[model samples]
Every structure is written in structure tokens, then in C-alpha cells.
Target: MSLTRSQVESIAHLARLDISEAELPVYADSLSKILSFVEQLSAADTSSVEPMAHPLDGESQRLRADEVSETDRHEKYQANAPSVTDALYLVPRVIE
Candidate 1:
């Protein structure tokens, strides 16, 4: 699980990061330790374990009614705006 200097450089490039020469060795060592720890975690026996959506058991996520309870007020709201066109608010062009 040891990472070389070149591997660290490649990883940095893929992640779009700018790593200095002095920081390369530090990143390489840290990444190597993280990969080694993940390897150790994968070796654990999970055959008897049951997969769960959450950590706690016998508890379901609370859900509210999916039906809409409010009436549409777009036109009412647009009346207060300075400018609106095609159901979209128009601000002064600032980029051009």
C-alpha cells in the first residue's frame, strides 16, 4: 500500500491540485497510510452482518405528506417585481 513519488504526482494531477516538491513526500506518506488502513478494514469478517440503511434498528425515517398544500401565487408575486418576462425576473445586464 506504499505510494511512490510518481503515484502521488499522478494523484495530485487527477485531483487538479498543485503540490510543491517539499509537500510531495508528505502527501505520499499520508495517502499510503490511508490506503493501508482501508486494506485492513476490508479484511474484517462481515459475513454474519446485516446491511442497514441507517445505524439504528427498528426505526423508520419520518416522512410528511407528499401532496401540495399551497396554491400557486406566481402572478401575485410577479406584480411586485420591477421587471419580469416569460415568468422569469429580468435584472439589468451587468456582464456585457
Candidate 2:
């Protein structure tokens, strides 16, 4: 799971990342350690574990009732438009 300096450079190129000569070895070591940790996690046993939608499955989420809190003011705002029709703003056509 360890990554080489050349592999890190290739990854940086594919991801469009700018890595200086001094930082390439640092990035390579960090990426190699991360891959090793992921490999270690993949070796765990989870066959008896049940899938869950939420961590707090017994608790119910309290939500506020959906209601209109603001009045419609389209007519007042449309008064400033240079051109409008049927509550819709008119714009110049750019394409044929």
C-alpha cells in the first residue's frame, strides 16, 4: 500500500496539483500512510453488523410545521422592470 515518489508525482499530475520538489517526498509519505490505514480498516470483520439509516434510530426528529411566513410582493418589485408580461420579466432574445 506504500506509494513511491514517482507515483505521488503522477497522482499530482492527474489531479492538477502543484507540488514542489521539496514537498513531493512529504506528500508521498503522507499518501502512503493513508493507504496503509485504509488497507488495515478493510481487514475488519463486519458480517454480523446490521445496516442503519441513522445513528440515533430510536429518536424522532422534531420538525417545525411548514407554513407561509412572507407575503407575495411580486407586483411591487416588477414595477421597477423595464419590460414585464403576466408577472414575468421580458428579456431580449440572444439566440435565433
Candidate 3:
């Protein structure tokens, strides 16, 4: 699929990118090639393929045990705050 200069400009605007006149054609060609590659991938058959959670079978990701490791110091910390209510810090409202 070939992309025109105007399409490239629209893409740039949507992506919040600043593209110069000299780079517009280059970007358009590159984006067109990417879209073509995706189209080719879509044409491949994968009806028998099994979905995988991870590449390695029987190998699960290890995670640290969830446990409380610190003592509560809310009263000590709240003393330093300019304003706090019910263990929550109070901030000035900037919005109307």
C-alpha cells in the first residue's frame, strides 16, 4: 500500500509529530512499507496454533512473597504535615 503526502501529514498531526517538508516523503514510504508487512502477516494461516502465556513451558515467573515489612508510623509522619485529616494529607484545591 502506497501512502500520499497528505496522508503522511495527517498521520503526523494525529501523532503530535513535527515533520518537515523534506522528511514527509521519507516518513510516508516507511509507514507504507510497515503497513504492507502487517498485511502480509495477516495473510498467514495459524488455525492450529496454540496460544502461549510464555515462550518456555513449565517455567513460571518467580515473585517475591507479599508481606508487611514495616511498622506503622502514621502519627509521627502526620506531625510534620501542614494539614492532615483522618490519616490523609490535605492539599490546596487549584481547580474551580
Candidate 4:
């Protein structure tokens, strides 16, 4: 899975990277090696491996009770606003 100079340039352009002409060859070689390594890793046999959601499968996640912990202060906060209607702030229309 070796990457050519043109392929590297296209990848850089798609990723919004500014690869200078002097560094294109370096990037090409580095990206080629990375793709080759990924190919090698993909060739490994993992048919017997079981999929896992978490590495520590024996442990359960502790969760706190879902409850309201704070008092509503919308009226107090809205008092400072210049314009509010139906619990929503009104702003000047800048676009038609």
C-alpha cells in the first residue's frame, strides 16, 4: 500500500494541509510507510477474538441517581435582559 507523490498531494489537499513542494517527497514516503504498516496489521488473524465494549468487562460503571440538584433561576436571569418573550430572548433581526 505505497502512496505516490500525486496521491500524497491529493490527500494533503483533501485534509486542508499546506504541504510545501520541498516536503512532498518526505510526506509521500512517510504516508506510504504508514499505509504499509496498516496493511500488515490488517493481515493478522483475529477470527477467534471476541468483541468487547470495555477492556475491564468484569467491572460495572457506578452511576449517580438522576435528580434535580439546582433551583431554577430563569426569572432572575431574564430580569437583566432588555427584551424577552415566552421565556425566549429577542434579538434585532440582522438578516432578511
- Model 2 per-residue lDDT tens digits across residues 6-81: 9999999999999999999999999998998888766779889887778798787777789888799999999999
The sequence of per-residue lDDT tens digits that candidate 1 reaches over residues 3-72 is: 9999999999999999999999999999999999889777879999977678767676778899998899
TM-score of each: 0.47, 0.45, 0.46, 0.47
lDDT of 1: 0.92
Q: Which ten residues in a row are the worst by lDDT in model 2?
A: 55-64
Each candidate: what lDDT?
0.92, 0.91, 0.91, 0.88
Candidate 1 Cα misplacement greater than 4 A, ranges = 46-96
Model 1: lDDT of residue 25: 99
User: Candidate 3: where is the Cα deviation over 4 Å?
Assistant: 45-96
Superposed Cα RMSD, model 4: 8.5
Native-to-model Cα distance after best TM-score fit, residue 4 in candidate 1, in Å: 0.4
Q: What clash count goes with each model?
A: 0, 0, 0, 0
Instruction: Select the stronger candidate by lDDT from 3 and 4.
Output: 3
Compared with the true structure, model 3 gives a TM-score of: 0.46
lDDT of 4 by residue, 14-93 (tens): 99999999999999898888888788766778889887788788777878789988799999999999999988899998
